[model samples]
Target: MSLPELLLAGFLLLSVLGALLLSLPIAAEQPLNWHQALFTATSAVTVTGLGVVDTSSLSLFGQLVVLGLIQVGGLGFMTCAAMMMVLLGMRLPLYQKRLISESLEHTSFAELAQMVRLVVGFALATELAGTLLLSLVWMPEHGVAAGLWISAFHAISAFNNAGFSLWPDSLAREVADPLVNGVISLLFIVGGLGFVVIAELANWRPGRGLSLHARITLHASGGLILAAMACVLLFEWDNPATLGGLEGLGAKLQAAWFQAVTPRTAGFNTLDIGAMTTPSALLTMLWMFIGAGSGSTASGIKVTTFMVLLLVARAFLKGQARPVAFGRSLSARTVMEAVAVALAGMLLVFGCLLALTITEPGQDFLGLAFESVSAFATVGLSRGVTAELSASGQLVLIATMLLGRVGPISLGYLLATRKTESLRFAEGRVHVG
Candidate 1:
């Protein structure tokens, strides 16, 4: 098996084992069914945040198991394994390094070890900072110990874009607290920005412009976040179900901004997502589907794919022969891969949506579609179907979450097994419409 595939398999296997372990009486008051355990395990390992049951209801032991799975899944199993190998004073086998490279989406092994070290360091630093900031807001409500745990859990969840909240209602209760909202939102933004983007920004040298990849990621992600914020504000400004009922204009704006930013894979909701207007929901779906950047904990087709597609379209519109971005010509192969990834992702969402609609015919189509898209994108913003999905519906979401985590293209690669070429095909002419 290819290194990526092996790594993914190992992760799935570990998740199942973890879930089984969590199902023991010692882990929970009530034993969970195999399906429930598998689903929860997959969701946590994938960082998709779709829970079949209320996470807050789980025993402390069970919750810790889930949190551990999220941490392993967020950084990737292979990545953590590599770190462990390094800590043991063992050199990573060339094969293992290649696997690590694929798992982290790096192009080379030149600095693979350093990159892994950097990823772990930056991730821990950001999460710790986030926890300290959030503790200031959470400590008054909960005691020191509980507050510290809450802060740490949320910090890891936000920085990893895991979206598993300790509160049953997620972060909706904190909408009015500007400090909490601002800190969490900042963590979400930083996490969703992709590690490579942040690393490049951190090591950026003055007078040496950003790399093409970094530039595309930054511009596309920034544009989408701003556009989503504006659209949410415009569509829900007067909607009572969402931000409209807030007492102050500043609170409303803050809530809108937070909602717009978090849905792009962080999955933390500061407002009633189910109460959002159809237009706002639709806009949020778009943002989630175009999610964070490639190689990040966040999923979806990725910001880079959307940016590449846009560049391709722009080139075609201007009658240019080649697609170029930031004065760098994009490889044809990259454009094709982006198109393939997007097509595969959309197909998966559509297929899952169809299955969900059939399984639950009485539910709202828009709501079902939203849930399917959320699962497929690994964005986790749902309109309350998560707790209500039937066995079949849950299975559909499980498949979507797996595809989202492994990537649609990666799954396709596994299935296809081999690429086909045609050099002797006869060309045929057809009439234009």
Candidate 2:
């Protein structure tokens, strides 16, 4: 099988295995039906976080099972396999190297071993640090044992950008708490930045600067985060259900910042997302669709793709031959790939929305649209529509999550498999306004 096909199969197998495990009576307080089990399992394996069941209600073993799925899904099955090989001191074969390189989008095949180490090592170290810091905040409240467990679960979820919270209200209780907000936000932000960027930053020196991809990821991410923050503050400041009820500007800003960045495919929100104004909700959906960097835990069309599209527009308006960024000209192939990814993502989201409309006729269009984007992007933010959806509606989301997880990788496969024209064809042209 092809690499993308293998990846899809691997992920599906993991999801199925997870579902089977979760279906066991010991996994939950009450036995979950097949659909509920599959949905939760698929959500975990895809790192999408949309749920038909409350995770907090799950037994300790079930939560651990979900965490295991989250870790594997976020790093990917191939990554986990590679980590094992590295640990065993096995020399990675050429085909294995190709798979890892393509999967991670790592450029240097020669240094693939080191890259795998960095990926696994950095993830473990960061999760550990986050857990310890979060323990300080939760231990005072939930006490020693439960607090540590909560801290550990959230640390893994946050660093994986899975957005799974044991609490029914998520982190809303700590909306004004700096330590909770800071550690959680920081973990996801760094995680969503992608492993390549992380590896580069770790080895970066003053004389040797960052790569273009790193630069673009950092700049676009920072700009988007700030822009979303401003938009949230502007649109929701006066809304009673969201930021408006906050006592002061400081707390409001903190909430705005958290809400703003969460939509960059992190999915943890402090505010009542369903209660936000239409504009704020729309903005949130847009960011969820944009997502974070490629090769990251979060998924969407990706920030890099979004920026490349912007560059394409700028080049067209400036009458330039090619899109340029950071003192480099993007290849025509890159532009086409970006267009393909964006178009495919839009089509998937639209199809999911259309399907949901048919499956959930009583639902509002806006809420359905939000759910569609959230599911496809794996952002997991809901406008209180998830649990209320019918079985068919939930099934539509389950399919969306699965396809959304593999769509980009499959697109990459299609793009990579393209063949150049063997013979030149006659020039064909069409007119447009």
Candidate 3:
């Protein structure tokens, strides 16, 4: 099987195994039926965080199972397998390295081994730091043992961008708290920025550092976050169920920042998603569609893809022959691929939304569409319609989440499995728009 298909198969297999483990009576407070088990497993594997069942209701064993799935899925199946090989003192096979390359979208094999080791070490160290910092609040609030566990679980979840919260409201109670907001927001941001970016930034020097990918990611991500935060604050400032409910401006701003960060596929919510104004919700969908940077745990069309589209638009509008960004001309192939990925993602979201609308005839149109986008983006910020979706609708979401996590880039490649002739065709003339 091709690497993409194998990767896809790996996710399916892991989801089933996780579901089976979580279905056992000892795993959850109430035994999960196959549907609940599968959905939760798929969500965890995709790191989507859309839970039909409240995670708080899950027994510790079930939660742990989910954590395992998130780690496997977020770090990627092949990466973990490769790391295991390293731990066992075995050399990575060439085939395995190819698999890792496909998964990480890396073209260089020379530094592959060193890069993988660095990624794993970096991930563990980040999660540990997050756990230590988060414990300051939770450990005192809940007792030593439960709080420590909670802290660790959240640290992993946030760093992995998994968004699996043990709390019923998913940290809504801590919306105004600076420590909680800052730590969680930073975790998802770093997690979504891509590992390659992180590794480079760690050893960066003054004035001359950062690769083009890292530079693009940092600037685009920062701009999007700031824009999203402004949109949320401006649109929902007076909405009682969201930022308006807070006592002070500082709390509202913190909550706004948290909301802004979550939409880019983190799935953690400090404010009531459904209660936000329509403008804020629409703004969120835009951000979710244009999710975090490439190679990050978070998914969507990706920030780079969105940036490419914007550059393409700019070129067309200015009647330029080529698209350029930051003094570098973008390749035509890169531009076309970005267009394909974005278009495919939008169409998938649309089709899923249409299906859900048919299945859920009485539901609100905007909410269902929002849920579909959230699932397709793997963003996990629901509008309170998740638990209420029918079995078919939930299945649709499961598929979308898988697509989101697996991504359109790989899926697009999967279609062209056969070798093509080196024949060039003339551009066909078509009617102008």
Candidate 4:
């Protein structure tokens, strides 16, 4: 098979294995049926937290299996496989290197080994630190054993931008807790800022500057978080089911900030997502669609794509020849790729929504749209519509999650594949409004 086909097949094989394991009697209090097992496995493999059953319904072994799947999924299994090869001191063949580079959205084959080491090492170290810090908060309430397990689970989940939580309400009880709010949000934020940016930050020194890509990622992430936070605060401030119920400025701000951060495809929620006003819900969907950095655990068209769209529009309005940032001009190809990603993402979400309407005609349109975007972006935040959907509707989401996770990368591969053209076509013009 070609590299892209191989790459996609690997994920599928792993998801199937996960499904088989999850279906075993040991995996759940009551063994899940094949479809349920497959759906859960796919969601876990995609690092999208949407689930048909409560996580707590799973036995200890089952939860661990899910956690393993999350780690493998969050850091692509190819990276894990390559990391194993590195540990064994085996040379990466050209094909293996190509697969590793493709998985990470990286361009350098020579750096694959080093990048793999860094990615795995950083991920484990960061997750360990998160576990320790979170333990301090939960240990006093729940005993050491339970507290530690919870901490470990959430730390891994947050850092992976996989919003799976043991609690049904998903950190709502800690909405006002400063420690919980701070740690979880920080984990996802750092995780969502793809490893490329992380590696740059790690090696950064005085007198050396970040690349244009890193700069735009950092600036756009911060800008989006702040903008979303402000908008959530404004739109939900008077809604008693959301921000208005909070006691003080600190609590409200914490929840608002978290709500803003989660929509960048993290999927954790401090407030009642289904209870938020229509405006806040719409805003959240927009951010969910934009998502975080490229090659990050989170999925969507990615923050850079959204920023490029904005830059392109600004240039058009100003009558500039090209979109430029940080004194560097974006090539036409780059701009066209950005537009393509955005349009494709929109169509993906639209297609899912259309499918849901057919399978679930009685459901609210807005809720269905929110669920469709959530699934396609792999954001996992639903408007409480997930459980209500019929099996067919859920199947539509299962496909969406799988496709959403791999679609962009696969699309990139197809576009980048060289195709010989024997002749040049004549220029054609079309009029637009």
The TM-score values for the models, in the order shown, are 0.94, 0.98, 0.97, 0.98
Please list the residue runs of candidate 4 whose C-alpha ends up more than 4 Å from where it truly belongs after superposition: 420-422
For model 1, give the RMSD to the true fold: 2.3
Q: Work out how many backbone clashes candidate 1 has.
A: 0
Backbone steric clashes in candidate 3, count: 0
Model 4 worst lDDT window (10 residues): 411-420
Model 4, 1-433: lDDT tens per residue? 8777886787788789999999999999999988788888888888899988889899998999889989999999889989999999999888888877876775598888889999999999999999999999999889899999999999999999889999889999999999899999999999999998898899999999999999999999999999999999899998999999999999999999999999988888989899999989899999999999987899999999999999999998999999999999999878977988899999999999999999999999999999999998988898899978788998999889988998888877766675868999999999966
lDDT against the true structure, each candidate: 0.83, 0.91, 0.87, 0.91
Candidate 3's C-alpha runs over 4 A off are: 412-421
Better of 1 and 3 by TM-score: 3
Alpha-carbon RMSD of each model: 2.3, 1.1, 1.6, 1.1
Off by over 4 Å in 2: none
- Against the true structure, candidate 3 has what lDDT? 0.87
- Give the alpha carbon lDDT tens digit for every residue of 75-113 in model 2: 878877887988998888887787788767644788888
Model 1: lDDT of residue 362: 88
Residue pairs with backbone atoms closer than 3 Å in model 1 (clashes): none
Q: Name model 1 segments beyond 4 Å from true.
A: 408-433
Judge candidate 4 against the unseen true structure and give its global Cα lDDT, from 0 to 1.
0.91
